[model samples]
Target: MLRITTLLLILVAISSCSNKKTETEPLTAEHKAKIVGLSKDLIKSINDFDFSIVNSTWSNKAFKDRVSNITGTQKSVFEHIFEKDLKRKIKTGNLSIIHHINSTNGAASFFNLDHKDHHSELTILLTYNDNFNFFKYRIEIENQKPVLSDSYNFRDNLWYSEKIINSLRLASKHNAFSNDRRETNIAIHNSDQELLKGDTLEALYYLYDIPTTHQTGNWLSFRKLTLAQSLSDSVYASVMVTEYENNKSLYMKYLYHLYFSDSTDLEKVYDILSEELGESKTLDSLVSSGSFWD
Candidate 1:
């Protein structure tokens, strides 16, 4: 929590600093100082365990709506960790706000709080409004890397954002043998290679069993087999994505989709990757659905 005098001193310095600058139409220090103050108040309320203040402060933010969509189990978690952290008492010092302004939508603030632990928290967010000021805003204590990396991606028939799914790891697991295994196997059978192909209907049964504790000891996933099946039929027209041995390189690892006529005769097509993988956005479950990693 920030001391009352510390916040005042910081605000005064910002106000004085603004007086010396010739500003343009972009965000001004004076305007940002107000936002910082408001953000500080919210933090203050949270530290004091004053739910009313914390809740009422963001009356015009998108986070409030997102909070409403949180499930009961999710709520229980926040009450345990997030709520406790949000409301814990502590002495804070050296507060600074960085304002990032843009040509399009103006800017936001990152509330930098220096604490006794020699560590600091950098929070960034904004109460962005449309042309109509409809209270459509976002106030997140932004982090470049979230708590969860991969999560359960349940999809029926829509493209879900990778940012959301990756941010929550939800109820998911990394059984290096399940998802990739099963998907590969299904693709093999679909390609029509007798030897490479496994029991398709059987693999399908264990396909979604991942992200669980149930140990269904059966063959799962098959891409090589999928290609082999294609080869057996004379024309192997399928997508193939190569995995990098060292995925930490970011650019080294990739997700590929390809089609081929035979093992030797092939058409290299449809490929995309980025040096930016684990960004806060998301890594969609489309990979599991055989969308691009076919």
Candidate 2:
């Protein structure tokens, strides 16, 4: 019995030690350096419009499987498509890595690539795997990109209006709208005014202020609040909004469709509001106060 007890204690100690190691072990400087070097090389390749480097940067099995699943195309055909896409990006200009976050197994790097006209910028996110191999990336374009905006000038406004209307309607169905209807009406009216004035970000905030019962999850309210707050700096809005949209949480998707749909009309009031509200406040406080609508 004594020997058995000692063995059990020893096993427990070993397990505790293993857990501590895992919990405390952070990515080493060497690992971070490796990730940074890999990221630089990948960005350089992209700027040079050399798709061949992808053959080395990407894990062959993973890339091949993903492309096959998505397009039902063989590796050669997918490479051709990828090359075309890279060429288009090259036309924009060289890409520069601006920020990165490294993890034990991988890293995510943010890049800013200038537009062809050099007037605007596009943000790209590259996600790598444990092997320091890139497996995915997302490029966010301006909503007013020539191809989409030229053909449909007012599409963004229309989309925003529709979303607000639909969300309000849903809230009503759930009896989430307040009895006074004053707040709800004000929200709709203010949003409309901002939309017409081309202050898209403020318009979104007005729509965000409509109070809903907590039981209903107030999904739209939370989503729009997050979006409005993030849009305080319109230059980084696309990247921030895209990251939230891609978040695995289903509630986060409510505002995903709002991004890259139109050019934001700059609002001077954004700075004032951001300052007044205290930019670092948690999302819950922002939603509860409803000061943004005021």
Candidate 3:
């Protein structure tokens, strides 16, 4: 009887543990609801140009910490550059009013909850009238609240985290180029930063002041082409297409054209591009997406 009682107690304890594990195993529906709601709020903030609300939803501190870990103590400097330059540009009306948040949610995934770090990757389709773009956000839990930690735009094919780090590295190199070219570097960095924000025209405005000599490159040409394509400026896009096609340098290739060099790889790149960019305004299938890594 004693042995049977001990066995029964152990069994009960084991069952309780199993149930507890099961409870936390799946992403709770409540958590999913919170994430979806948070996404909508973020989109609204961006559309409204309320950087205060945008700042609240994003963990810039978390971003800085991550950047510090990777780039080593340059977070403050990078943040300063971003704030000063981008703000000045906005005040001057270079950046356009971001359009509405017309989006259709896609897949959402949850990962690394045990570490108290929740990576909620949500893919969604963002439409601006007839043109469509794919955007993905990686929402993470920081301080018991959900915040956007990183984002990836299908157009750029690069995450914002990567964009900032790269921008910081280049922008901080004061001796890398002459003063004029240094300004160009800053402008290029600013342009790519705007691209991350889904502002094609403002991004182009940053690039516009770049010296004519610095303007010609496979990467720059392709960047302009995609931005032009997004705005449906056929004439500008045609000029960019010509420049992109005629460029011979193999050095600094856009990710979009990297695959097109070979037949087998081209097919794979095509399928993914088609899916991400959707069918409308595909430049007649010549160029479906309209952004690239800088």
Candidate 4:
């Protein structure tokens, strides 16, 4: 009996040591629970189409802090959208709590929300404010087609991520990240004619001179230069690999349709986009033509 007792105590000591050595990051369970609660409240506000409920759930100071920045009628318009169709548009297909690399000042919870109807997935960023009083939430959506770019931010007015990218990378395997990733460059010599085009390096250069991107995952950011997705065969690429010979007008028209559709009167924006495309396409073609590639 004494031998058995000694053995049991040895096992208990081993169990304690193992538990102490486990690598779970340090965080107060109570604080973590609060973070989850706030995140849920924010999502619930959005799902129920109740912006007023947000006023109730969030601290008055935080509410004023966020809303005060909204200058005018834009607030009303923005509020209306959230109070109405925002939830109806994207359903919470799935949600999971993601750990933060370090939980210092406050907390950040990353969740993947599936909107199966739209064939889109949203990576929701819920960041607890300094006091853990409320959450500053932003959502980034990637569609079924898997586009990762910031170009649509101008059109959609929906903010993506400046944080929560690493967790996103862990979710998608095809996500590629490298400093060597080259953006397509299209340079214009004359406003009317292309000096050079096609930088094999960056797809964004093909999209624009300034590479503004939305997160495709953690490692990739892409913008939609052409709003419309064109069906390109190897034959098509071989025939007009150079910008001078490429169908720029057709591509532009397709892009216009992608963002504005056939009926939108947002022409000034489209004109700016078109002019930028002309410059980007030129540089891209010149770079892509090198013999290093087929």
Candidate 5:
């Protein structure tokens, strides 16, 4: 009788543990729908330039704190920032939600922005507590989104760029014995000129096209390490590290590289270009004329 009771107790405990595991599993379809709905609503608010709606989407304290930190005021000053900094060049009609993903602790929405004369992308990330009350949110934009270096083709471009750079480096090392050193030098110069004439984002995109072999991992790791060493700004490093922690994607790393090379905030760079070239005009003229990096 005693043995039977002990066995029954063990069985019940095991069943209860299994049930708990099932209950704590990741998001279901219902959760996804809820997250997607929130994202769509936020995009709609942006299109309408309705701050009331935008204000409602964000947590009051978090939104206020961020605005205050940036503007040095506790009042709601996001409208001015949104208008001049973001919406000035944006074609609200072309804004569309491209993707949304939910994690155990939060969710993120990716948006494609086809501005009047250029294309860009935005990412909105939200983090919430267990009760589902979001405590923090962030919106990041990548201006002048590279045509060929988009998420779909980024890997291929990186692979190709890696091959080109590696070949050039190898040729230089063996140039002491090679009579064709002049040819290698010409190749290097031509490649540099090509890069100078191309979009900076596109140049960085080539890094993603490298083939994934055993050496690829080592090569990327070394590049990342080198990039970290090159950055003099601790704040930027901190931000990049946080972003990497949240989204461990190759595309994100590429964006970090671009940021490092440019050494300027993405939005500021866009704003400067917009002012110089006119917001109503297209970037095609500048992009086609010569490389902005040059």
Candidate 6:
């Protein structure tokens, strides 16, 4: 009787541990289905030029700080520019022209999801009319609803975090310890605005002239490389590659180098990029048209 009681207790403990493991598992099929549905709805809303869905998902702080500037009724430098441009394009029926170029209707292809505690990350291969880009969202559960805290855009082996803090930082009147740094930051911001407005050459030359002491970041140098690539100025791109030696994506650097190489080299690079990106036709169109935006 004593032996049987001991064995029973051990069995119960094992069962309890198994139950705990199940409870902590990141995502079950049902949760995944719900998340995917949310993602699809977000994409559809964007395609229709309804930004409400995008705004609705923003975390409390992101919503308050990202859409408007520090001053009253002044729109964010980043959001205002892009949102206005997108709305204009939609109104002018320019989306159809872009779609014709890519031969693809904008679609959301779910790539990955990682869940931890009340936080989750979702990465999707998003086709935004003319571009195939990766959209990654950092989501957190608040009031039992998923809200976006931040997002990162991955394009052509370069990464851009859509930071709302730039507006606040730029608006602040406080002087930095180094005046040179402050001026450089302002110059870079202006250059970014030009790039957003499609003044590629102006943006490239302006950024290129910043003093090396203040332009120490690899991202700054990489930005020049992208602009040069867009303009098909391989000579300038080669110079940028030397400055931006620590870029995370070596293959992307190689692709840029080969983009203006001999025909055989171009073919080989295209095959490698297509295999890696999984969007051969879209890439081909973008390259052929010589209008790859950052």
Best TM-score among the predictions, by candidate number: 6
Q: Write the per-residue lDDT of candidate 1 for residues 74-93, one digit (tens) a residue.
A: 33443454345422321110
* Over 4 Å off, model 1: 1-26, 59-294
Better of 5 and 6 by TM-score: 6
Q: If ranked by lDDT, best first, what sequence of candidates would result? A: 6, 3, 2, 5, 4, 1
Better of 2 and 3 by lDDT: 3
Cα deviation at 199, candidate 2, in Å, is: 43
- Per-residue CA lDDT of model 3 for 1-294, tens digit only, reads 999999999976764443231111234556666777777665565555555544566665554444433333355566676577733442232112233341322122221122222456665444443344456666666655666655665545666666666666655553456685677888989998999998888897787667654554345766676677678656464545455455543322233354334545545555656554344344233334533222
Clashing pairs counted in every model: 19, 0, 0, 31, 13, 0
| Candidate 6: tens digits of C-alpha lDDT, residues 82-163 | 4656334322432332243244555555656666564566765555544455556666544445666555544333222223
Each model's lDDT: 0.30, 0.38, 0.53, 0.31, 0.36, 0.54
lDDT of 2 by residue, 1-294 (tens): 999999999976764443231111233444334444544565555544454444343332222222222211222344564466633442232222212222232233334332232122223233333121112221112221111111000112122213323434444444435553667677878987987897867777676465553213334444455555656656346534644543433223323433433213212233333342234233234334432221
Task: Give the least accurate 10-residue stretch of model 2, judged by summed lDDT.
Answer: 146-155
* Residue 223, model 3, lDDT: 66
TM-score of each: 0.21, 0.22, 0.48, 0.22, 0.20, 0.48
Q: After superposition, how far is residue 13 of candidate 6 from its true place, in Å?
A: 42
What is candidate 4's local distance difference test score? 0.31
Question: What is candidate 4's lDDT per residue for 161-257, written digit by digit as tens?
Answer: 2221222332233223522122211221221132133432233233334233322221221122121123244422332332213223433333334
Tens-digit lDDT track of model 5 for 198-260: 533333334333323212223444344344444446734764664545444444554565557
